[model samples]
Target: MITFESVTKRYPGGTVAVDALDLEVPDGRTMVLVGPSGCGKTTSLRMINRLIEPSEGRILLDGRDISQTEASELRRGIGYVIQQTGLFPHRTIVDNIATVPLLKGWPKAKARDRARELMDLVGLDPAMARRYPYQLSGGQQQRVGVARALAADPPVLLMDEPFSAVDPIVRATLQDELIRLQAELRKTVVLVTHDVEEAIKVGDQVAVFYPNGKIAQIDTPQRLLGDPADDYVENFLGFDRGIRRLAFFPADGLDLQAGIVLGDGTTVEQARRAAKQAGESWVLLTDAGRLPRGWAALSDLESRDGREMLAQMPLAPYGHTFRVGKDSLRAALDATVLSRTGLAVGVDDQGRVVGVTSYERLRAAIQAAEEAADGQGARPS
Candidate 1:
């Protein structure tokens, strides 16, 4: 556990970087410090490892005052990862990962062996072990940096916007990798990021810092979105917080309608008659293999056209399918909006459309679920 007791950092210019802040980070849980620039988020993380000293007060690592320990020794027991990676340009990937182990007086062969293990743990192929940092991609280099941090099996790990420099796609992948690693290793992680979304995605607890290094609020991601403490925190959470919160609510068990899905090779006469009989403006279509193929308008196929001509008419494309009993309410809502008919499609394990649901129905279902949960919470245990 990390405890910050009235810790403060005042620069040489007499400017306060971190005010007398008190915070507690639980053991084996990730705590993300997030805010705009000059928020002293990075400063707080540095203070943990004694990279930067506090001007007043104390920081305790598992009850030992960090200030009492030598900086180099303290750092050896803690792992640190930075944005640009800070990897040695000429060092091989294995050597880079084994840097800390070698520094701690381990045999070269044992260090190399541990480096290989970490490479696999971080999802990097063992074949890349011989390559230099310059030979790796941005994402790959970041993985090396992480491996280097874990080399000595440190219980505490610090990361500063480690995935920020990469593209969104790669960043997401890296985020998933970190989540996987944390599940397996459960290090006491303190990560710093300016991206609120990233903080919510990865943090067990999020600390929103103010300009003067004061924490505006600290809470779990769901609570932070559902209940913002102030205007500053609300504005930082963005305008679509309500919508974002729906990710936690599942779309399963909501009222869904089994749709009229006509398979391919069904004649225009058959489709027109089906649409008229069903009283639907559009008929759901399936490809030759019974998979969803957009929706065909009843009016477009109403002409005295033959099967070939009807096949040529454009079918409005639908959104991706939401799996019943699996996906979130947000996914269901998005699927409904993306479809031309404004109906969310639910699929089975085989990827076949099991049913369709309307937006109004989804909203009511969510409301009921919330009410039930609220009622349960109100009941005495």
Candidate 2:
């Protein structure tokens, strides 16, 4: 556990960057510090590794005061990742990752072996091991940086705006990668970011900072969105707080219409009957494996007289699907909007369609989730 007891960072001119701030980062959980420019989020992160020493008070790792340890030795024992990667230009990817282990007097071959293991762990190609930093893309470089940080298997990891340098698509991929890594590694993490959405997506606990080096609120992402502590934190979350809150609610319990689901080999009459039973204008047709094929209109099925298969007719696109029980309500909502038939396809992990949910059902689920959250909030802490 990392505990900051009345930690303050005051400059020579008496400009306090962090004013008597007290925060606790539980072991093996992620804590994200977020705010606008000059909010001292980065200042607080740097102070953890003694990069920027506090003016007063104590910063303790576990039970020991960090000030008693030599700054270089303390940093070597902790993992640090920055936005620009900071890889040595001339070194190979494997060599870059092996820096810390080699510095700590591990054998050259053992350090390189550990580096190779970490490369695969972070989803880098084994072929890229011999490549230089300049040869890889921005996203790949960031992965290498992550691999290097975890090279020594440090207990705590500090990251500052780690994914900010990439494009939106790459940034999202990196964010997901970080979440997956955290789940597997369970390192004590302190991340500093200016993006609130990123903070919500990755943090187990989020600390929203004021401009005066003070925390406005620190809470879980769900609670932070459902109930903002003040106007500053509320405004920081923006107008999409309600939508963002849906991320916490699972989509598994939604009432899906399975009656309108038909096999590709189904007869025209069967499709019409299924659609009528489900009170839907269209029927979803699936292949023999239960994978979504497309949507077949009931009117089109009715035009055919015989026992013709629904597969004979032209079908509309099914848009996208969300993993039921695995994805959040927000993902289901996105699928609903993108669908051509105004229904979200819920699928299993194998991408086989299980059922379909309508917008009305999703709306009801959201209301129920909000009501439950409100009920919980009314009770004493």
Best-performing candidate as measured by TM-score: 2
Please provide TM-scores, in order, for all candidate models, with all chains considered together. Answer: 0.85, 0.91
How many pairs of residues collide in each model?
0, 0
lDDT of each: 0.87, 0.92
lDDT of 1 by residue, 262-350 (tens): 77777788888777786667777777666777778887887657565345668887667898778888888888877768776788778
In Å, residue 266's CA in model 2 sits off its true spot by 3.7
Most accurate candidate by lDDT: 2
Q: What is the lDDT of residue 58 in candidate 2?
A: 94
Q: Over the stretch 1-381, how does candidate 2's per-residue lDDT look in tens digits?
A: 999999999999889999899999999999999999899999999999999999989999998999999998998889999999999889999999999999899999999999999999999999998999999999999999999999999999999999999999999999999999999999999999999999999999999999999999989999999888889999999999988899999988688888888887788888888888888888889999999989988788888974888888899989889999799999999999898789978999999988999999998988888887787754223
Q: How close to the true structure is residue 153 of candidate 1, measured as C-alpha lDDT?
A: 98
Off by over 4 Å in 2: 298-309, 372-381
What TM-score number comes out for model 1? 0.85
Q: State the lDDT at 234 in candidate 1.
A: 93
> lDDT of model 2 at residue 259?
86
lDDT of 2 at 192: 94
Candidate 1 deviant stretches above 4 angstroms? 259-290, 296-315, 369-381
